[model samples]
Target: MIRNPSWVLRSYPSGMPTVGNWMLEDRPIPEATKGELLAKTLWLSVDPYMRGRISQAKNYATGFGVGDLMSGGGVGEVIKSESPDFKPGDIVVSDYFGWQPFTTIPASSAKLVAATDAPVEASLSFLGMPGLTAYFALLKTGDPKEGETVLISAASGGVGQIAGQIARIKGLDPVAVAGTDAKLEWCKQLGYRECVNHRTSADLVADVAAACPNGVDLFIDNTAGPIHDAAMLNLNTFGRVVVVGTVALADRFDQPDIGLRHLRKTLIARARIEGFLLDDHESEFETAKADLLSWFKQGLFETREDVIEGIEAVPYAFVRMMNGENFGKQLVKL
Candidate 1:
């Protein structure tokens, strides 16, 4: 008699979300039907983008309503399969799995986890959405060139860490801007040419400018707000800005995003700014995944995971990540 316990959205948050916004309920485990697979979740991912999903405001994807299951990405082992493409004991990853221990999803919606020397949990971090986001966003959007300075905000984060490493690999100089001294130290080990602790810096713009003596040619913005302002002020002529996450403004999503305008700097620097979403680059996923896997196996990449155990810890884990307490990719092992 297995039970499927899920975290359900109890209410939308007006500011930062609290555990009160969700309710965990126990239900019967669902059976796999035709063309579907029933899987037991092994690892669950908690990311900043999830903040948007729980919001009442409109997003590119559908938002969850009160009483709906809190959905996210998860890697699980197939316990039962009714589809010809999969069999029992196969491991798969899917975005359709909610905050639950077991899920029954259409086989077409999940992808088989490729064999890797790295832990299967890597499928959710550097080798999955975060890595893919960093890959296409930097290479395609930022368009890095040799010797150029690429400034990365949230440089120690899941996506930011990978982005900075990719920049270094491409012969570009990576300048890291993270919140803590410890995080900046980790970025240095990852090959970043320079590091700035935004939380302690008296003048971030000046610090960023000093780090990128030649001016920033590419800015991979993940935290936005002050980091965005700093990068814009130091952008080089013909530079590019790839907007990723806005974790700094997570609490203000429901309110107007009031901030310093960069229009003047944009015009003066002739810089190109573009927002990125991993979902938009589906056609290039396999190619990017192949490259990431190769780079990872060759010892060219490194990442950290802040993991917690049990289904009951999911909500608190997410809150910790949102508060910048998690060192790297935040995960829940069930």
Candidate 2:
């Protein structure tokens, strides 16, 4: 039997997780039972949302229990099957899978990934959760109109990149806010009309205001700290805010973070702010995926991925992503 190495939660993290928070353990690989398939993992995703799962605090999703096998979205090739629906060499993707070399999953639970000109890794990033998140949040929540200004936070990140591009496609002007120069440059290349350095800008409010002279009509917020506050201050009379992620609250969700109170601004602007979780829009996945794939094939959409080799790198890769050290979608290749 092949030995499968899996990353398991070693402890609940108090702050940013380290290697000490995880343990790589080996276990005997087993054959698939009836109606199941055995898969060899090829790509595993590490996202900011995973940070919330490791914490004890209540999040939009359930938290991972201590000593549980760390699981997330992954792409794999079927190595063995006991079901008629799958055969050897079939490619499949799962939103629930372990960070391991191999996994035995029920055939019905995994989805088939059709062959495409784009790399299969896209299934975990742009074409997967991140892309889906961007599509739904921008189209449904933010709802940008033609010629309107859309501002995106964490603009070089997985969902942010796609969010900006989708806004541009829908005839809105996209302005980006990023932490680093390289990330700002990436936002520029993705067709952002202006990029603000939220990390170094002396007066973030003024900086965002200058970047968006007409005021922000739509705000797609991935980080919810200073950027959100500044966006709130610059909202148009009929603006919309879609709070999709909270990277700014990483490792600090247990504590209340004080910032500008924007109630008066929302009240006067007549703006709407809503929290968006992707799972709430499962019915919209097919429509979003089709639109994203079409734009991607037409060269209007593209993605950047930061990949680390080997399953052993999952812990460090996740930490790097959580710390905003990864420039794009972060993944581990086994």
**Which candidate tops lDDT?**
1
The per-residue C-alpha lDDT of model 2 at residue 44 equals 93
List residue ranges in candidate 1 displaced over 4 A.
Answer: none
Tens-place lDDT per residue, model 2, 39-99, is: 9999999888888898878787898888888888899999998989889999998877688
Global Cα lDDT for candidate 2: 0.88
Over 1-334, each residue of candidate 1 has an lDDT whose tens digit, in order, gives 8778999999998788778889999977877899989999999999999999899888877999999988788999999999999998999998877788988877988999978897999989988889899999999888888999999988888898999899988899999999888999999999999999999999999999899999999999898788999899899999999989888887787887777988888898888999999989999899999999889989999998889999999999988888788898899999
Q: Which 10-residue span in candidate 2 carries the lowest summed lDDT?
A: 249-258
User: What's each prediction's TM-score?
Assistant: 0.97, 0.96
Can you list the residue pairs that collide in candidate 2? Answer: none
Best by TM-score: 1
- Global lDDT of each model? 0.89, 0.88
Q: What is the TM-score of candidate 1?
A: 0.97
